[model samples]
Target: MNVSSPLNNEFAISRRRKAAMIVQMMISDGGNLSLSQLPESLQELLTDELGAIRLVDRDTVLGVAEEFIAELGSLGLSAPGSRDGAIAALSDHLSPTVAARLREQMESVRFGDHWHIVIDLPNSRIVDIMNAESVEICAVALSKLPTSKAAAVLAQTPGERARRITYAMSLTADISPDAVHRIGQSLAKEYGRPVSSAFDKAPAQRLGAILNSAVTQTREEVLGGLGEDDPEFANDLRKAIFTFKDIPARVKPTDIPNCIRTVDPAQLSSAIASALAADEPVISAAEFILSNVSQRMAGQIREEAEELGTIKKADAEAAMSSVTSAIRDLVESGTITLRDPEADTDE
Candidate 1:
């Protein structure tokens, strides 16, 4: 009538048992380890091992730590653990076609079960699968997908399919890995879209981002030329480009406080002074920012900027660009929302 403890076991100390001990120790010590980055199978084993053992002797904890440290010291090199990672690291050395082929071959490797790939498919495609495939397969698919996306797909699915799929999910606890793997492979073959990770973003967005960093004169020249040759692309690129002048149009007034907080006081002053320095300056941008911030802060910044007097246009522009970059970061982080440009705005 004794419950076995993985950590307390003095004999047959497996690597997994030791790992669970270390992971538990780290968690107890408030370490924010990204255990999610580990392969799902490994995570499951770690979770199981951790669950089996309630407490560890200090000696076992110290032994595990010492062993882990020694093992780390002994490693001269570590290769990329997954084929995708390996392919990316070796891409410069490998032919593009070869690298792509290797990426496709990833299905037979760590993703051999193919559930990861299946779950990454578009939500609409998943809904279509639910419509066409058996209720059991749809249930298995939902179980494989991340909870939020699964919920969305289930909500979008027809009433009958959704009800059946939910019932099937309850019965999925005992499904065999081999059967799940087979289902995943079949689903992927039938429905998985070939995604090219060649570029993390669209071409227009990449080009626009490059222009964001370019000197204003150079950016304007390029945009002017592009406008003539490829009006459609140029129009799209213009939407992506958010410059100092675009602030008044694109950024929300309410976000100004949070946005400017990211900039240094001197940098903000310089940008303001320089913008106002021009013969026909960007008054709207300066006013937009000043109006949004507190009156005291606005007066202080204006006074400092005026005192600096005649900052080099280039220096001022650089500071302004820094402010714009901070704003972009806030937008990207979902901390602030930008007002839509003319293209998106209601008349």
Candidate 2:
């Protein structure tokens, strides 16, 4: 867990070659390598007298040297060794044009922060890193990462520890860039390789999906902890979760008939009646349910509901709750699927 020397050794030979090449380039150009002449990545690696050079293997010296030449050429100034000489020097190591194109491609490729490095790590290694840090620090670190990555890591962690980490993340409001960079550097040094991948779903939505599968007590505890740390964030997470009430708006109209058939007819009847009896009935919910059922079935349910008269508010709610819970279960079990309204509109 000690990250004193986390950099991968696999790139050591290449790094040394690049470092030596950079030194050669500087010497050839009459030691005129200026900070402004380097790519941001190379600039960050340089120090006074190159005292602390830590070349990232992601780029080669030839590549950076080409960029340096192009930058100088743009300023209408020749490189110290002459642009031709520098180009020849770079071409001696690698094709200058190809290297420059490769560098350009590298520049275009984006990698997420150090947290991404952690996610790319093996689960056992990720757990080890998490175990090495305090819950608060780990949570804050995880919170800064993409939600899918954070959730994947948390899901792999032990349940109790995961809960604590979730609580800590919710409480964390601000994390400095320095801290994140350091964490990422340490992780990259220890466990990462140069790689890139796309992110999916917002953190709230991903976390909501994970929580939806959780046991009620654990879900409540995590939400309660989140509520304590940041109520607004907790509210957002809650909204991300699709509940029974969300069905009217979220469920596909085509899927409704099958969903209705999954519930008990009597239970559906009582639930509909209770919904109708509410001071301001959820007309959308009633209509949605009725619209999905056959006309005869819908009519029969209406008659049965009328005979039932005014059921107790609690009874009505209980009946409705059961139907709602059933719908959620079906969705979770893949028996039904709800289309996201926002996603539809976006299309």
Candidate 3:
């Protein structure tokens, strides 16, 4: 038979029972515990032990808390048990933008680094950030971007300022990695700025897009009036417009195949015929489309147009509009990019 002395009886609590008593004692005294920080398995065990155990003496509860505190104090350091937990711990040490960026990039291999995230920013955003930030900051961001992206962004940046930023790049070879990372993180945050307006595109872009589907005469008439009254807006609208005549200058040769798929084969043939029968720029645009397509396909388009006989002026206008509409769709979806129109190119 086993005999228990009073001292043994007082100290007889099991580990789990002691843990429960300590937890209850802490709660009773108004201490808040973030029990959720523990590993889920341990949390479940603690919850179950806490619920199953009933009562403990005041001395036993006090002793358990002392032991728990002693053990915690004896540990030199404690690391967060998970990657997310570790990020949360150091989040206070970082700027909010960098910290949030770190959390987003933690699970993504695509970004690789902060500079790469900035590289992935649209060229327009990069230009905006360059315009808003100091010349030195712009120089750092421009240097960090890939050669191709940097060149494209610089093309859009103001000429004299871009030249200054470019020259500043020569001095950036000795910049510290930490400075570059912080600059990139700041730019990315800027890129993430919320749009205050409901519309996704600018007013001029919206007006031009609506005009794209309108008849050629309607587009010209509206622009003529806008030109007299609102020349600045008209100029912006002209830059945004993509007409059948603008095809050769704005659309790419390689993208011709995708446009062919976008419109019906018969419709594409009719548009080309319509353009061919029209004036200089329209004829060139027709030739651009036909030449870029396969030889067999080009031959077929000519054959189909011939079989359809002389297309009427109204029919031709409608057909050409269809082609332009398909190109506009491709541009909107980011599937194809338009070439920058030359200064002399008329809308």
Scored by lDDT, the top model is 1
User: Which runs of model 3 end up more than 4 angstroms from their true locations?
Assistant: 1-195, 343-347
Give the alpha-carbon lDDT of every model.
0.83, 0.65, 0.80
Error of 2 at 60 (Å): 40
How well is each residue in 211-309 modelled by candidate 3, as lDDT tens digits?
988888899999999999999999999989999999888887889889868797778878888787889999998889889999998998988877777
RMSD of each: 13.3, 18.0, 14.4
Model 1 scores worst on lDDT over the 10 consecutive residues at 3-12
User: Which residue pairs clash within candidate 2?
Assistant: 6-189, 6-190, 7-189, 114-184
Q: For residue 312, what is the lDDT in candidate 2?
A: 80
Residue-level lDDT of model 1, residues 222-330, one tens digit each, is 9999999999999999998988888888888888999999799999999888877664437678888999999999999999998999888779888899899999999
Instruction: lDDT winner between 1 and 2, please give it.
Output: 1
Native-to-model Cα distance after best TM-score fit, residue 75 in candidate 2, in Å: 60
Off by over 4 Å in 2: 1-185, 189-232, 279-281, 344-347
Q: Whose lDDT is higher: candidate 2's or candidate 3's?
A: 3
Model 2 per-residue lDDT at 135: 89
